[model samples]
Target: MSVKKISRHSPPNCGARAASASVLALMALLGAAAQAADTYNSDRPGGADHRLLSRYQGSLLYMYGEEALGKADMLFDDKGKPVMRPVEGRISNRMYWGPKKKSPLEVYRNYRHALETAGFKTIYACETKQCEAGAVQDAVQDLPRKVVWKDSDIFVENTFNSANQPGFHYYSGRRTGPDGDTYVSVALAGGYEDEPVFGRVRQFVQIVEPATAELGKVSVDAKAIGGALKRDGRIALYGVKFDTGQAVLRPESTAQLAEMAGALKAAPALKVYIVGHTDNQGELQGNSTLSQKRADAVVAALSSKYGIAPARLLGRGVANLAPLASNDSEAGRAQNRRVELVVR
Candidate 1:
């Protein structure tokens, strides 16, 4: 055996370095994927920060004073009633979907965990068999029927129509936050669109903050109203107040009404339409009705109390058809909800 040069070349650390680089590259790719998945629009009213998973797609339909009205169980018909009670400030329903890889139960559990971690006390939770099918359907029906998403119907059919799966989950609870108390409800269902390959979930969130305080001082007086009418042919009145979900004017609205009367009296020849506009909170029909009622109330007040000619003021309610600002935020909604005097 000739002991030929048995010199063994030491193996380079290239393998280890390559493995490490591969892991880092994988991590970077994964990070990028996660970032891409975290692109849900959170520009909702009340709060923007939400504790939702990054993998799920989200759709939101929110109202400032939406009744948390739905069935909590299948015992009896909870129709037109808020089984979980009502939220005074803001109510939002967010729908989500993910691949079938994540089971409905898993999604429910993850949201439950998130709520718990965020100091929310679980008031109610139920699984597939434990949850009543009828109650779930009733609750889904309570959500807005027509939500426009990307210029198309979000819920193509009934909301409960897609939630006809065998395994479903529901949850409801309350939590206190820095601003005020908040309530949350969740529903998770399997097999969306008759397709057993996708999963769907919905979250109904209610944020109840202290009622917005009445403005201490009136921003628009008769002079300002007169100037605006002279220049812009219309003037939006912000000092007018109304009870939530009702056409009844609050007592604090007297000042604005007085100024409106004064403006009318000062300009006897000016005929205007008392147009009532509202934030897009409820159904178009209902909003239209409410706005008409509110406008009528204003007309009645000015005629009865302030002695303004009823013929010069024509009351009309256009509802949310003419919005001054985007209804996605509370401030914008407030701006949109106004009484406008349009010169006729």
Candidate 2:
């Protein structure tokens, strides 16, 4: 299920028009309030401020969320492409709604200055050329699974993904420190051919603080995987790591995914169920949805990246129903959060 493509309104001034055209046609009730300082209301009920940076005064915060471990594309490579870097620490995404007259370039430049003034060195700056969608989507799409998102979040995500495509500005910078580095990427656009009420300019901001990904926490050894499957019906794998609220496996999980592929190759006739399990933190239904997506992600990764046969692997999600350990404590919860391969 792909997100609805709606931000088709490309500003006339923005050089490259987005492939399509459509501003977010939100529900009438919600659309009226997307702006923070509208005629009747000027209240800030949503998250007012982000930790590393402050919000632009005039814009309304459409959405705000953070991830413990997430992926973000940062510095540009020699080919002038954004590098998809895994953020180890806290990843904060803030989406804002800007006034129509204001072009996206203005807000983007202000954000660039803020980062630079705060000691962040500009690493990737492509002001005129359009920014890549992956760098923007990575931040916009990562939301917590536990909470029921507001209508505004969906609207913001849809609008920015379309608006940031072409005729926009992208800037990413990093700051070095003794402990680690901080990364910030800003994507914004201001060209609306259609509805003016939906917001002429929108900005998507992602900030990554330094942290550890618990590297080498687990080894993806085919021999061990095979041995465990031979002895037991299934084996629990923690090596397939995910952010607190994300289903996509972390880059660190590549080794494990590769080994899983190897294990399947060793036994040509082997057919197994790839089961996704989660801690009992959020609602059961929500956890089940996340688990299912994760199971599907693993299956897709195996099929696409490792050349594992799709027929050989079946994906399922049992949510918190099958717990490896008690969910009473943090350690137990961590133990319970795992992906398992059970022999069929």
Candidate 3:
């Protein structure tokens, strides 16, 4: 066919091209929004942004990937009846499942699969709320490949998910351990007693753990030491035996030591003073000696076993001075025997 001659300055085809490009841009924006709603920042703890988890107001939460399954908060319907609705991502109980009547392992597996399909590689999960120390350790040991645990506390692990987005999930129930390691768990969310409002497809996206520089691990007991380490320059660690009064280091102390060592190593400039205490059973002088001995023992272990410097280790004896529990009873006496660390 003979080609028709085209004028060099004819109305450009730019109109159609511009319209196509606009459509493409709109699609891209929409796609990005959808993705944002789907992805998890494993480092973000709660699957949202750092600011939201930093202050953490309200009881609303939005579940992505495994979190979306069968979770919602109860709201009174227009008919004065209770209904479940989507909880805001930052608010607590947003995806409250109330209580699980089924097996926690089942729930964990289901969530794990759902998360994996969404391409979230850092999957943190728990089986129950009251888990045994051994159970939690086992769960941690059994974590899927490539998932790094920030702490051994199952409950805190859940909160870690709430604070970060790398495919974090939690389960409610109890875990029992036979003296392997004391498993401390923090229930950050879940148990809202509602059904799933989102569709069956759980969204998952890659997320970096919240920068260790901010919104770090969370602690529920006492001073919330985990957050202290991440947000503040100092974290005070006190070691105590179970049932109190016993100056001997308890098994739980192992976990704390591990954490303290790691914190010191991570921040080379950090220094810590390890203090030991004894109950009031013995004479003041004897208790002081015992406390000093215990403190020295800790220093020796840290320096020799863990490679912490003697200069970095300061041992103090607080003899029956700091009592967390009443010393009137044997239980309280047990509480008085402890070792603590003051960050310098």
lDDT of 3 by residue, 125-190 (tens): 343432332233333322212223222233222432322222223422112222111111112222
Q: Which stretches of candidate 1 lie over 4 Å from their true place?
A: 1-219
Looking at model 1, residue 170 earns an lDDT score of 69
Per-residue lDDT over 1-344 for candidate 2, one digit per residue giving the tens place of the 0 to 100 score? 89765556854535343422223334544667665336213323566567778866677666666677655655554466656454446677776767556767777778888889999987777764435444543443332222223334345545544334444677788887754678887766664454533445667677878654543387759988998999997999989989987998899889899899999999989999999999899999999999999999999999999888899999999999999778765546778899999999
Question: Candidate 2 lDDT (Cα, whole model)?
Answer: 0.72
Of 2 and 3, the candidate ahead on lDDT is 2
Model 1, 55-82: lDDT tens per residue? 2434333222232322222111245223
Q: Which stretches of candidate 2 lie above 4 Å from their native place?
A: 1-46, 130-154, 160-167, 191-199, 213-344
Quantify all predictions' global Cα lDDT against the true fold. Answer: 0.64, 0.72, 0.43
Per-candidate Cα RMSD to the true structure, in Å, reads 15.7, 19.6, 18.3
If ranked by TM-score, best first, what sequence of candidates would result?
Answer: 2, 1, 3
> lDDT at 56 for candidate 1?
41
Summing lDDT over every window of 10 consecutive residues in candidate 2, give the lowest-scoring window: 140-149
**Model 3 alpha-carbon miss at residue 45, Å:** 51
